[model samples]
Target: LLELRILLHGPAGSGKSSFINSVDTLVDAVSHDSFTTEYKTNKIQKGEPGTFYPFVFTDIMGLEKDTNKGVGVEDIKLAMKGNIKDGYKFKPASTISKDDHSYNNNPTLNDKVHVLVCVVPANTIHLLSNETVTKMRDVRLAARDMGIPQLAILTKIDEACPEVKRDLRNVYKSKSLKKKEFSVSLGIPLNCMFPVKNYHSEITTDDNIDTLILSALRQMTDFGEDFVNNLYRPTSSLQTGI
Candidate 1:
């Protein structure tokens, strides 16, 4: 059993929230048509692996280059340092600082961000202007500095390739059709990238979609476990760069 904390990052409207929703749907193996009840509050959300997943996913506000909107680079640095606490609403106009109550002055291995998942929409990856790419690069370099392993999720595959849209079984083979959307152009290694489609418009679980999404989830969980397990090198190492 592996335990880790995964963070989802990307530009606004890239479907981070939708991806989380899809994963929750898959873990419970629940279809919208058969959902029996809804919990008003999610203080203790549970997942797969009997009691709950050994790991959990964290979704934060999107990143934008603008100084007055979206998550700031400084805030992202804080997140990578594991200083930001859960449920801390990100203020687009400002970044997190030591003054904030949610700031974790001394984060432990449990508080550190184990995995960094970059979510990008495949359909419009080319349209991700240099400004956006620059922002991503800045964050990537920051994560790289902290020894955090990052993975790119090239999402919205259904809208990127025709064959994949018709049938996800052709994802890897359809890379030619989706060559432009590939993360190689984004400076990320091809092996560390994944293509997935969220179930935003679906009412039922489609095996192909689940297969792709779950595969990515499993791969990310593995990467996260590696980082968390490695944190035992020394307690001081975790707080050095912060």
Candidate 2:
């Protein structure tokens, strides 16, 4: 069976990698400096050996405020169309073209991104630079043109709000995030925005963390399945023709 492809993108240190690790015990490379350069697709292994879940996650380098640094917005557009390949290193100076060795000329429906999740730090929403927000919105518009569903993941809620920090149950009650403000900023609806704390510095998995992660994941799969089911192309088609 074909697995849903979920693509994650956002500013530096927004917890994209950490969220993936929390969702599925996969080992994704992370750094304190917010440097993730490789394009990687992660699949969750099922209980049985050599088996995987019905969905996969793709992680890319974080977006930077500088136009000449970090990942370019054009590269993200290509990724959504499945034009980029795994392990492809991002070049800030240029984007991948048809002649690039890392380009994927033939991409199936499974290779295309079913859902685009923008991961950002909850506490830093108000502090995001104008350039970064513009970059994010640019990518969102591209996804919209391609008919891809988009959502936002607000990470580090504990650090963003003291009330939530005391108890995760107070997530909705806390007024710190100002959901509407960020919703307007990112062009994402209140319903599509999800708040979750990624698993970090914890020796064992916590119920609260798992609940939040699973909640967002369930939503992702739901949106992804809806997109895949509505696709005009056959599931087994190898070329997207885009």
Candidate 3:
């Protein structure tokens, strides 16, 4: 019985859009029994048929290594504060401000991002450009400054490790997972990280994939609740698991 805004930030080709589609497919399968895994629509609000997510997941454009391309750090910071409106065109070198037409001058708590979920592809962690990593880190720091709780979703695990691709249950023991940089650089701990495989080639819903997706989402909601409710009452409860 809780709803919180979850903002997704990531680099290009990191599967942010695909992850949202996966959530929609999983909801259809678990709640109903019909889901089609066709090509990715690359659209937002692609979740459950005739259903809406209680908590909104805002997907911004991908970030680039330099300020000259992709999403700017300032724009992301503004987004975390819920200032940027939906469908607002992003500028590579400029960040939105109070004067921007799309800026939400008065954002409610619901409009602001309660949970910040950083999206990074597991397979490319080793190959990330230093500038990209640095820029992402800057975004993370901005979130931290505002006391916003953070979690990261490690997407495309199947492509990262063959063992994981075969059986997702073996994710924890897979020695090949690129967990170091995420844990150390982004400050997302080993426990906070949720490694998931987005639905790409398959048509049917897999329990393993669904579980991973839902589990991560569940935690996101929990943390979001923790941040929002704690604002009014700090010592409610800390035990939220699915």
| Top-lDDT candidate index | 2
Model 2 misplaced stretches (Cα beyond 4 Å): 26-34, 232-242
lDDT, candidate 1, 112-213, per-residue tens: 678888889888777776777787888888889888988888889898888889988998888644544465666778778888999878878889988888
Put the candidates in lDDT order, highest first. 2, 3, 1
For candidate 2, the per-residue lDDT at 85 reads 90
User: Candidate 3 residues 62-138, lDDT tens each?
Assistant: 87776688888888898888787776777776667578778889876656788888999998887888898888889
Q: Alpha carbon lDDT of residue 83, candidate 2? A: 89
Please tell me which model should have the higher TM-score, number 1 or number 3.
Answer: 3
**What's the best-to-worst order under TM-score?**
2, 3, 1
lDDT value, candidate 3, whole model: 0.77
Candidate 2 per-residue C-alpha lDDT over 1-242 given as tens digits, one digit per residue, 9 for 90 to 100:
28899999999889998888787743223223246898999887776768888899999999989998878999999999998999899988898878989999997776789999999899988888999999999999999999999999999999999999988989988989788888898999999999999877766767887787888998999999887766645763522533
Residue pairs in collision within model 3: none
Candidate 2 matches the true fold with a TM-score of 0.91
TM-score of each: 0.84, 0.91, 0.85
Each model's total of backbone clashes: 0, 0, 0
